[model samples]
Target: MGTNQVEMCPVARLIFVVYLLVTTCSASPPNFVLLFADDLGFGDLGCYGHPTSITPNLDRLAADGLRFTDFYCTSPVCSPSRASLLTGRYQTRSGVYPGVFYPGSRGGLPLNETTIAEVLKPLGYATAAMGKWHLGLGQNGMYLPTRQGFDHFLGVPYSHDMGPCQNLTCFPPDIKCFGHCDQDVVTIPLMYDDIIKQQPVDFLDLERAYSDFATDFITMSAKKKQPFFLYYPSHHTHYPQFAGPGAAGWSRRGPFGDSLLEFDSTVGNLLSTLENTGVLNNTLILFTADNGPELMRMSRGGNAGLLKCGKGTTYEGGMREPAIAYWPGIITPGVTHELASTLDILPTFAKLAGAKLPMVQLDGVDMTDILVNQGPSKREAMMFYPTDPSVRYGMFALRLGKYKAHFYTRGAGHSETTPDHDCHIISILTPHDPPLLFDLESDPSENYPLSLQGRPDLQALLQKIQAVREKFEATMEFGESQIDKGIDPNLEPCCTPQCTPKPSCCQCD
Candidate 1:
């Protein structure tokens, strides 16, 4: 009888091993739905302690997922930040430094760079970019999302608020007001798979339309039994924060609040689609912003809570963003203080999907263990890139563990209004000879700069950072499109009814 029991145990173990292999193979790889917001602040959502923004959907999503409080964006502005998130490399390495591109810029993500979608394509994932493709309007669709691995691309070629209109009523009148300058400037084209679907699309109609496109993509992907990667970079919460008819006046905070309400609905609709398609539990939805907020707009923009300064600066408020990752039944719901960034998403998703990574050096570390088993993130250091400066000393910060050293101090809480092309670009940055050091663990707001007179350790840390910066800046390459130039309105895609009342030939699409 004892011999029989031993033999039965061996048989039981074999069956168990086979059973594990079968079940794991039957389970599908988790789908990825990256919801990227533009110019959203840390304190914009109820979960992040906003006083008035109605973001129940986002708040609930945060409650159901891992909320990362210390997450950061690679750059403080749009184009470079977008580049870092897609390629998981620094703006300097990717040649996307100094600034964002306007429409029809000759620069974009180089064709050689491997995007997250490109790497995941071999893994049978259906990829689609459903909103805000702010990475330059490539020459002849050279750098378009469709060319960069997205099966379908639908969004504006650039920002919604870049066009030829010069109406004073478009925004608070200023010679520098490049956005919301009228129905024309803010009314950029809407695109669908390389075709300009409509020139000067109503900005108010976009959020809902993007939501529809996202939901439809999810339904079709689920039906086809293919795990999908949907990059929904929403254009709301930027400038001209307009809401659709159903979402208008939904919040008490004004147009920004109305935009938040509509944005919340967009999340709710996407959640419903996931739930309806039975993919909610098998999908990982990462919600975060490209950068902090546009602070120059005062109350019209966003609030970064206790973080100092705002967009286009190297301050904490400019780069630190609110991030959440939701994968029901997979990621244990909770908040994490781990230091992560948008750069980590590409590598993390690669590991999650069991896909082969590109044979390129990456600035991002795989955060899979931290996301899945709540393990410690091995990320120890992060370098901060100033918003739009070609020179290294203009403004840059380097974070090593809890201590952060700022090589250059810049304007804080001041709006840099480009009044005209002739005016010198507004900048508050002042060169720091010895650099400023702050213990981020104690001073998250960075209000009080530490006295390096007594702390040799801090001084040595700064020296180390300076050495790293010197080595990095030596290899820095700049792209032609990233030279901080606004789009020539003449290059704006297609004309509105007023621009060409009866267009039968040019830009008819």
Candidate 2:
């Protein structure tokens, strides 16, 4: 049998054994709450060292959970990043490149593919997804949340700023585009079984609003002692900023900071809910963002600090994000510098729940040890590809231990200024360049590239990138099998902005 076919060692098994051995007690699967923020950058939170940002709630989360110093989202953009998260696989493998799904776009998550929700639903867990579900939209393809296993979903089908605005600026003084942008003000219109029960959720009051819903959910489930998965996705900090109720005049950082306040309060609310429900000690809470901040417009985002590149680039800023996991009685409060990816969540959750994952090809390994056991890091390298440009889609990135290699094709009009440097068009309309190598450990900022003259090892790593690229090309050229095998037949065709209809849909059975 191939290595891919081998059953991965269950990290949950070790957790269960340890629990029984230490406490002399069997364990019950804890309720899972995934608090996902939209386009939240690495330095946006107070824990990550944002000087002016006040995220007391999230800071508290770090104080109580395992704070990950080197964590990355699978994709750098919103939709594809989210797709990778939902399926626990690289978006590229699933043909979910970058770019938001516009109205009438036929693509969504492939129906046949299993999602985190799908994997958990069968175990008697009520799975719900709230806030930005930007996977895809429309009929005749697989983008709707229902097809992907989310029992309840709310918020915009795509980014609040995806479509054209009333005016050039994302913020509204103009009512025409603003009204369209706020279409979801009345419950982002129901598709499938999911519906936004409430409409016009105040952005500033989001933490309270969503928390109320999630708290109710937890309380209801707790009353019945039922295990449930509540996926809380936030729309704050994305664009078209709305300040939280108490945060209206709070920050000097403008609307961006206001959004951050809402996010902080949201986490605080969840934590409070867990504590009040008597599940704080048992419930496992994972907090992370879809991708790095949007820095092209400084008025909208904060710096990735020393990290090179900001949203929409292959640089660390685009993919690297703030991540922390907490289960008061389970995870020790401290920092882990090991590299971890959002993709690992699926397998990790399965292992923790004592559930066997269905036969499926997953690009992510379960990082249960990193979470529970004080074991060495399991993820040595990660492959990154941003299929979307406007948001994030690095052509290719591979992290081998501390050394990371990035291979990107600079297409036309790539120039965009950022806080640290003047981003300009490079290698435009040309063949890809030699890979850029960086020692992430020595230089977390990725400011200096290792000189090739003294580095044969670096050259070998670049060669590895070339080899990986060749294989990827072969898969695309030969029309490899699609990733999602069980997509709803009624779901639409998921594709990128410059997508060409392939002979077969991007489905993998």
- Candidates' lDDT values, in order? 0.75, 0.65
The sequence of per-residue lDDT tens digits that candidate 1 reaches over residues 141-233 is 677899999999989877766554333222222222234433433345788987788665655567778888998999999999898999988
lDDT of 1: 0.75
The prediction achieving the highest lDDT against the true structure is 1
Worst lDDT window (10 residues) for model 2? 183-192
Candidate 2 structure quality by residue, lDDT tens digits, 1-509:
00111122567556656763543222346678998888787877788888888888888888877888788897667767887787887676566654545444456666766788888887777777776777776564246676678766655576656433333222223222223343211122222244333222333334555667777878887777777788877887776666545665477677788777767777777778778878777688999988777675566655576676666666788779899898775776778877788888888888777667858667677887777665556665677665442222334667867877766533212114653442334534222356667899899887787878877977887787667656544543211223222233234322221333421222221
Name the runs in model 1 displaced over 4 angstroms: 1-27, 164-179, 182-187, 389-395, 412-427, 463-491, 495-509
Query: What TM-score would every model get versus the actual structure?
Result: 0.85, 0.80
Off by over 4 Å in 2: 1-16, 20-27, 140-142, 163-207, 388-395, 409-415, 419-422, 425-434, 460-509
Q: List the residue pairs that clash in candidate 1.
A: none
Best by TM-score: 1
